[model samples]
Target: MRKAVLLALFSLGFISCVSVKNLPQNPSPYISKIDLVKGVKQEGERIVPVPFKGKIGENPVIFLILKNAEGKNRVKFRLYAGKTLREEYEISFGKPGEYYSRVIIWQGLKARKKGTYTLAIFLNESLLAIKKFRIEGLRQGP
Candidate 1:
């Protein structure tokens, strides 16, 4: 009985140490680029993130490039209006094979009010990146 108990403990120790790497949840995945850009513009064959003031009607874009991602990953986006949490979104990633790399583009977002805002990106409940931007004032009619 004592030998069986010792074996069980050793098995549990080995299982705890053996972890699947390259997952966003474990040890965190690698993020090559995370940018809050105005929009994606094609210059030649490459798309780039351009900086500009975010306006009310215009859509705010986020471009991200990730590496070392595996199957079934969760990404969360939070937009905080000052100290209050204003907007939130959850995204999933499922790509075949290991040593994964991909470019993710998020768009079609608008601000409700003109103020300073913070954008936070999380990978499987882990904070991956954060950005700060301001939405301009509303247009006035003459």
Candidate 2:
């Protein structure tokens, strides 16, 4: 009876090991901070960033603050205008295990249709964050 129990236990352990080995392992990317802000000048000196409130038009900015990002990671930043892609940016991380931040700004956009727009950020093909803002009033010409 003792030998039978031992053999069964051994077989169970072996099966567990094999199952674990066969399971797919993927590393999860971590983001500490993300904000969609509008760019405004303070006293005409420097631009200050503030959180978006579903309203923006002239100058829009997306802030991506990251932590624990390591090793050759590709990050994609995209801006969309009512289901149409406006701009895209891809940033690459060269070193491993570091913290970094990036701010993307759209300067002097000409006559965008008054509607809601989307800003999406992706890390390694996974969407990490998204934000939306709306432009009111008529389209301002360039």
Candidate 3:
């Protein structure tokens, strides 16, 4: 019938418009969880998670869990002391196969100042996650 045809076309157009608006802005891998840990240990091709408080000492480690990560990708971590950019670290992945889930660990970062610090994680130049922590009882030597 003519009425059925018009209703079908209307539904199709409405569905297409809704889907277009729901599309993700960034097609890069998604980070499911981010954690600040003291250190990481490797065991049989896996990085073991370590316990950590919101406050850290000299060296700080960052742990990230990502999903839908495939092919070559770059991850960057920016550390800020208060509002000042303190350190930046980058990691590159060049794997052939697709990784549905991946674990990344970044270490060897030394916290120099004693105050609030913010860690920003970027996936292929896009901001993915952010975390804040504090450092106390830090002794500065002259």
Candidate 4:
């Protein structure tokens, strides 16, 4: 009885391990690390990032880093307020070699009301990343 229990437990563990190994792992191969910042400034040859928090002011920037990017590619940005789509933008790049650690920026996104907002980024029609932020304390004009 003891040997039978031990054999069954070992078989179950082996099956679990095999199942885990067979599971697919998927991650973006081109872009990583997306952030919403107040602004970015170039100091000498290095780019300095200013972190943004709480209520955003005029001109918020979307900063992201790219890796292993090659050929011609298109990146699309979609902004949403709650479930409503607010704005959409697209940019294209054509290069021959692989891009390792390239910084891309998007500007001119305005949030006029007080609510939660979502930014979705797509690379060549594939969804890459999403960021959520909130805006509060805006006075209505008379």
- Highest TM-score: which candidate? 3
Better of 2 and 3 by lDDT: 3
Q: Between the candidate structures 1 and 2, which one is better when assessed by lDDT?
A: 1
Model 3, 21-107: lDDT tens digits are: 466555567877777777888899887867565557656677778877877788888989989898999998767775656656565
Model 4 lDDT per residue over 54-95, tens place: 657544787777665656788888999998999998888867
Whichever of 1 and 2 has more TM-score, that candidate is 1
Clashing pairs in 1: none
The worst-scoring run of ten residues by lDDT in candidate 3 lies at 18-27
> Clash totals for all models, in order?
0, 0, 0, 0
The C-alpha lDDT values of all candidates are 0.73, 0.64, 0.77, 0.75
Show model 3 residue runs off by greater than 4 Å. Answer: 1-27, 139-142
Model 3 deviation from native, Cα RMSD in Å: 7.2
lDDT tens digits, residue span 35-120, model 2 = 55565445575445565566565545665556655466787877788898988887776566554443333233332567777877
TM-score for each candidate, following the candidate numbering: 0.62, 0.53, 0.69, 0.67
